[model samples]
Target: MRNRRPVGIWLTTVLLSSGTLLLSALLAGFLAVVSFRHGWVRTSPLYGIIAFLLVSAIIGTLLSAFFSKKVLNPLIALIKATQQVAEGNFDVRLEPRSKGEVGELIRNFNRMAEELSHTEMLRSDFVNNISHEIRTPVAAIENCATLLISGQLSGAEQREYAEMIADGARRLSTLSRNVLSLSRLENQGIITERRRFRLDEQIRQAVVLLEPKWAEKRLELDIELSEVTYEGNPELMIQVWINLLENAIKFSNAGGPLIVRLSEAGGEALTTIEDRGVGMPEEVVGRIFEKFYQGNPSRAAEGNGLGLALVKRIVELSGGRVGVESRPGEGSRFSVSLPMENC
Candidate 1:
């Protein structure tokens, strides 16, 4: 009842096979007339020839159906599986028999479905994390506002309430900015415009910018560099360093040490930032690069959970890669590799 052909190759085979049989029968009849009727035994090979033609036609039709069905069976299965996938079933899989184009098609479809499933999971997780992140700060601000409105606070208490409000606002601002940065980094329209810059200088600038934050915690700084110059956007790479360092300072125990190292390893410029903090578990570290992923979701850290995600995206955009090594209670070390080119 679907407004399309039932199957294409089936019809083609039927038509071609039937036409071949009819043409062969006519040729045979003509040859019989030339050899038997005009030259030799004219008694009649007519009934015998008629029987042969009928049998040949039958065999040709059967063979055509047999060959055509072999192909049509897999084709129909593929079509049905695609329809199911379109109807929101990512679990449907096609098992094609032979290793043909059709088999490759099915394999690719399975992969696409798997990827879609993973992406959907990530999207759902992101939505939930974002909702929780927003709710906590908003609820805190609302509670503080409610206390002030109910006249339950003295002058000093009111000042404290105002400071709480300011703090919530700052957290929200940080969340919004990180979200925007992550979005921009993920946008396909944003491609890297590589240029030459000193990798050591970039790290120094990021450290300088974040010095006040780390200094307030009395965190000791360690630096080692090979004076590496690389081709990349210095500003974007600076953001990567800042985010990693800021995270280190935020999560590190007070007076702990932070190490920032830049060096050339195996023809690549590598920057590593290691912190002595409450590190992540191995399981969490496996998916650390995923967007909106937070190893600690207790809302303890002042982040929107996009910093590492942004760092990974920016590194990939610059023809580089990012990786993390961490274990719970020990610490985390994040490394990024970029091309070591003079441009």
Candidate 2:
């Protein structure tokens, strides 16, 4: 059984019941005083009735004023605040003045408002960032196409323009694919198509797939894999490895050492990707998994900010967690822990 607090409803009920009992006692006492001062036998029944009516009216008015201030006022304020929230004013907050249920209600209202405000801010940022990401590539492709159609460039210049166009198209394609994949993953609650596969082999394959990028940078690879077979969505798990590896490669300094390690501990497959690149501060590390959040502005052009967010959502759906440790200029290490059993 849940231990429930005896606040809110119980307090309100007690206050109202006590007020009613006190009012009744006062009314009875007033009638008794009138009857004793003027003899009950001598006083007219009409006078007694009139006195009772006056006393009842006055007491009722006082009680009404007291209850209105204590209960009705806060309720009215809450209604107005709700209206404001419905009108998209997420910034509205209520001061909790009353105790018991009304105070708890006001506190909840304030918390809800704060959360809605944060969500609204994130939504605005996502829209602005995505718009900029799409527009830049689109504009580049348009310019390149226009230049190519002008027929004023030499053969070498024309080829350069064509390559630029291709690059822009590729960026747009990748952005679209990432956005769609993230949307799909966000809606997914469980990983499907589970099967046992060699997790080590998958990581190795991802590294090999990005050979061109890492090779171009002359990055030294140090991989240590312990044989581990895991049951989960192979397609989605592969994306996790690819994205993390790509991120490490992109940030690594030229000819720097990139390390990949996989091992099993306590029935969890732990994988770490460490890169000798520009590490982030604590603040950046916290918000790195947020959608459209880029910690390093200088390297923002390399990719859209959806990669890590996708990695996080995928790992979570697979019943695992991903984390990172880094300090400024010392390099960063990303760790992912997945359950070895079916989740």
Per-residue lDDT tens digits of candidate 1, residues 1-343? Answer: 2334446755776777778678768766766666676656555778646755777667766776677677677877777777777777778877757578878887888898888888787778877877877887788899999999999789999999988888888888888888777877777544467678888888898898998999999999998877987877777888899889999888888899899888887889888999988898888888767777777877455677788888888888877888888878888899888866554
Error of 1 at 6 (Å): 3.6
Top candidate, metric lDDT:
2
List TM-score per model, in order. Answer: 0.78, 0.83
Candidate 2, residues 1-343, lDDT tens digits: the string is: 3333435644665676567656765675678567857787356655665666567756765785677567767877887788788889999998998899889999999999999999899789878888999998899899999999999999999999999899989999999899899989988889888899999999999999999999999999999999999999899899999999998998889999999999999999999999989888999999999887889898887889889999999999988999999988889999999988862
Pairs with steric clashes in candidate 2: none
User: Could you say which candidate leads in TM-score?
Assistant: 2
Worst 10 residues of 1 by lDDT: 1-10
Per-residue error for 227 in candidate 1, Å, reads 5.3
Candidate 1 differs from the real structure by a C-alpha RMSD in angstroms, to one decimal, of 3.9
